[model samples]
Target: MTAAAACDTAALTAHLVARGLTASPAGVEIHPLAGGVSNDVVAVRAPGLDAVVKQALGRLRVAEEWLADPARLDTEGRALRLAGRIAPGSAPEVFDLSDGYLVIERAPDSWVPWKQQLLEGTADPAVAGRLGSVLGAYQRATADRDDVLREFGDVTAFGQLRVDPFHRTIAARHPDLAEAIGHTVDVMAASRVCLVHGDYTPKNVLVDPDGERLWVIDWEVAHVGDPTFDPAWTIGHLLLKTVHRPAAGAGFAAAGRAFLTAFTESIAGALPIDPAQLVRQTGCLLLARVDGKSPADYLTADERPRVRDLARRLLIDPPETITDAWELLA
Candidate 1:
């Protein structure tokens, strides 16, 4: 069945029952969840089941006509399973993966998305520190695993969802920087360092209200590629937030520094991270969000050019350290 047709709540309920994930469809509360731009997400609550079910959309919900393989769902499931094994509680428990649908444990109500908190101007350094530490551990644990390399070697989804939309799209728009952007693409394509969560923005990170636990969600674009992509993606979002809410820029910058320090310290001895590569990727991502298929909605019209100029400057004169990139906003 087509992805659009399969998004029906009734159809999804039936699929869950057939897959033995739910005992019955009766009294099951299936409500749609927001914050997703490429897939259908529903919160399923039944007599004894409380989970989030996701079905990948062949055509993403973007103004641009973007298409991706539904098989990315399988990759997400596999990534979640691996993350659970590598760092238990860092990712939701996958209850079932059938066809193109995935049902995973739904986080508690108190666990809010870090993006929401950031938008509300509550910049918590602890959130960044936790994410850095967890992601670093995952990458270190899964590093050099040939089996994982083979399983996630296909960068089709990552290319379609990330590289094509963000890096390539921006490169086409800014022809002068095409060489630099293309170079990063080629380097990322050739590198097989560790598991890269292609989309590691704040929106995908969930933090408990009490500030004790955290979970990283949305691994649809996960792959085995450049280790810097995840951290770069994350810091890029924080930079955008800094531009969007300048009043909270100082706090956001601090969070970025904390996250970078924690991440670098966590993987200090296990793997070597190139500071220049991280800043280069960060520059590419900063430009992508401002002038790519999916632009950041939070930035104002006047604010976009500021980001554009900063991105270009960074690309031309890349920083030697991640902290130096943060200092650009200062």
Candidate 2:
């Protein structure tokens, strides 16, 4: 079915019923969920199901005409199932996957997106640590697995959702940085070490109010690629938060540090993380958020230039370590 046609609530409800996922179409309630630009996400409440359904969009819901394969929904469902097996509770259970829709366990109402919590000036170091550990475990468990590499070899979704929108967009905007950005892109494309959560940002992580449970969601871009990509994507967001909320910079910086420490510690001896790649990727991400197709809404017009300048510095004179990069911001 066409992406536009699949977005129709009545059509979606019919599809669910046809797939036998819903017992009745009359009582099923599907409401759109906020904060997704690449897909139609809905909270589904029915007689026997409380789940979230995501339908991948061929063209993203952004000002730019960003396009991607709707088949990436298949990748996300597979990744969630694998993650559940590798690290139980880290990712939601996939209840169903058909057509371009993925139905998975819904997070409790008590759980809020980590991005919301971070934006509210609440930087919990423990949350960062937990994210780091869970991600590390995922990478470690899936690393060097030939079966996994075969299953997730396609980088089409990652390219469309991330590399094109962020790295390539930034490169085009800043001609001088194109060479460095191109090199980073080359390295990431060539590397096939482990499974990478291509969008490992705070927005994708859901946390309980009491900080007891953390669930990583949205694995549509998951692929077997560079290990640094996940950590870099994550730390880059924390840095952006620091810039957006300067008053809470110290707290954000601490969270970044804690995240890196826990991440490195968790993967120690299991997989080696390249400091240079991490630094370069982080720099690319920093620039991307400012100049990419989907710029961070929180960054002011004036703050964008500062971010661009810092990103350029990091790209040209790459940091020796993640801590050094954080220090530059500090």
Candidate 3:
């Protein structure tokens, strides 16, 4: 089945029944979930079944002509399972991995995205700490593992979804910073120490209403690569939020620090990456959201220049730490 066709309720329901994931479609209800540009995500609820079905789109839902491999569904399925084992409840359980889609455990109805909370100026440091712990655990457990390398070593999907749109596209647009961006890209491509969640932003993190447990979604870009990518992406996002809402900068900064402290502690100081690397990655990510194929919808016209200016500075002369990066917004 085509990715485009999989978006329909009828097609998804039929797919579920054919896979025997659902006993019957009698009382099943499927509704499309909003947000996300790369995949068609639907929430399927039925008798004793609560799941999300996602199918990779060959072309993303963006203004630019971004095309990715539909086989990324297979990658996400494998990565989700591995992530679940590594972090234990940090990722959704994979129920089925079919030809073109995945049926996975869904977050509770009350669960909301961490991105939403951040946008509302509710930056919880504890939540950041938990996210850091899970990311550190995932990278630490999979670091240098031959089995992990063999299974997720491929960077094809990562390049298509991340490097091309964000890094490469941004490089072409910013000629002066192209050298710096190119260097960052080179370093990322050379490093293959652990599994990198290419899209490890707050938007992908689902927080339970009670704020006790959280789940990280969207693993289609997961691969065996630089460990810095995941942490940088997460920290970068916190920094982005700080820029977006300067009045609430203290909260976001606190969360950034909490995440770094917890991440470092979780890894037991074994994986020491140059702080500059993270600065560069964060800069690249910030610039990507403002000018790359997928712009940050939340950023306003007045905020775009601020992000662009900060991104360039981050690329040119990176700060000593993510905390320092937060200070730039002030």
Per-prediction CA RMSD (Å): 2.1, 2.2, 2.0
TM-score of each: 0.96, 0.96, 0.96
Q: Write one digit per residue (lDDT tens) for candidate 1, span 1-330.
A: 356544588788888888887788887888888858889888999877899999898999989899999999999999999999988999999999987789999999889999999988888998899899988988898788899989888889999999999999999999999998988888888789899989998999998987779999999988888999999988888888888888998898899988988988887668767777888899999898889999888889999998898799778888777667657766
Q: What Cα-based lDDT does every candidate model obtain?
A: 0.88, 0.89, 0.88
Residue 283, candidate 3: alpha-carbon lDDT: 92
lDDT of 3 by residue, 154-242 (tens): 88889999999999999999999999999999999988888888899999999998778999889998899887888888888887787
Those runs of model 2 whose alpha carbons end farther than 4 Å from true positions after fitting are 1-7
How big is the positional error of residue 312 in model 3, measured in Å on the Cα after superposition?
0.9
> Which pairs of residues collide in model 3?
none
Best by lDDT: 2
Candidate 2 or 1, higher lDDT: 2
